[model samples]
Target: MADVYDTTYGQADYFGSEASPLLARYADWIPAEARVLDIGAGQGRNSLPLARRGCRVTALEPSGVGRAAIKAQAAEAGLDLDIVGENFMSYEPRGVFDVILCFGLVQILRYQECASLVTRLHQWLRSGGTLFLTAWHVGDPSFARLTREWERLGIRSFRSPDGSQYRLFLEDGEILKLFFRWQTIHHCEGLGPEHRHGDGPPERHGEIEVVLTRP
Candidate 1:
């Protein structure tokens, strides 16, 4: 059974116009026809399109709500996708994929677990495979305040079904350093407090986008 945190799936759209930019950048590195793994996938936003384009897609979402959303959207789009409601720290890939996405996942665990996950994700990729990641940057003042509030509320350390706590924030160098074993293709530090469709952006929630490839 999923925990309280699991219910918060698909809360916000992290990527709006930037989705195209990330996809285009990924296309340049990943093969035209590739198997993609969307770790922490929510609602099949990016996964659905990739599957529609003829790529084999496997979305790994730990949240039941998130996984159900993936399936729901996949059917709505008529996109074939394999859904696995498994935690990232314990998720063993069936095989290496051409592209692996870790978007909006780094801050979802402890600092050490996050580090191990990056290394494991890199290992799960096939040679020349690409890994894309985006996370809320810790430098954002608004997010800092939010984290403090969540902590103050005594939910600072809520446990998930997988025994992991949820608090998402990452440093710039820590994110950039994930490419130590892989070659970096693209990296961006676009500050946004959650803006989609000219929503004029919010006051908090900025993210950093990263794309790296295994050699």
Candidate 2:
């Protein structure tokens, strides 16, 4: 995975310097001094902004390059960001966080892995803490291509166009089902323009954006 990101991060601006609009939109849900865990926090896109907002952020990333970029950006901004170079699956939470960011990661894991990860995340959040997530859904136009490949291979995972990466796409209600034990604050799934990672043409995707609070 590190090798994959090392190449991707080097080739394209997948993790932008600025915070994503999704994160910014829900920033108020996080208190001024809240503790935040940013899983798959590549290059501090969300971490830096949350830190600037007075949140103490712990950024967990798998790639060394990504972690280095995040550290450098945090330093340039003179912000204190706890950047951890580790995969989230093997990472042990030190303490409960007031808010957890899991953007653009759920769709990459196997079905069971996604289930287990969310279950662990539920335990990692404090009562009433928020978990924000974004993932590709079956409604996206890309879903048809991925589904065809999955059916051909008889597996849930689909390889990237270059065959260097594999990702999973969820269907309707999957996200809600995963967090059925929690209180859903917001959930939306529909067609949306894909993030332009590199100078590629803008494409449409079936995507799901969700915010849930642990009870």
Q: Evaluated with TM-score, which candidate comes out highest? A: 2
Question: Per-residue CA lDDT of candidate 1, range 167-214, in tens?
Answer: 656666667666676677777775754444324444555568778778
lDDT of 2 by residue, 1-215 (tens): 45567766774347566687787888888898999999998777888888998999999989888888888877888999899888777899889999999988877776667778877888899999999999987776866777655432324457665666667777788888878778887888988866677566777778899889988
lDDT at position 113, candidate 1: 76
lDDT winner: 2
In candidate 2, stretches whose alpha carbon ends up further than 4 angstroms from where it belongs are 150-156, 159-164
Single out the weakest 10-residue window by summed lDDT for candidate 2.
148-157
- Model 1 Cα shift for residue 13 (angstroms): 7.0
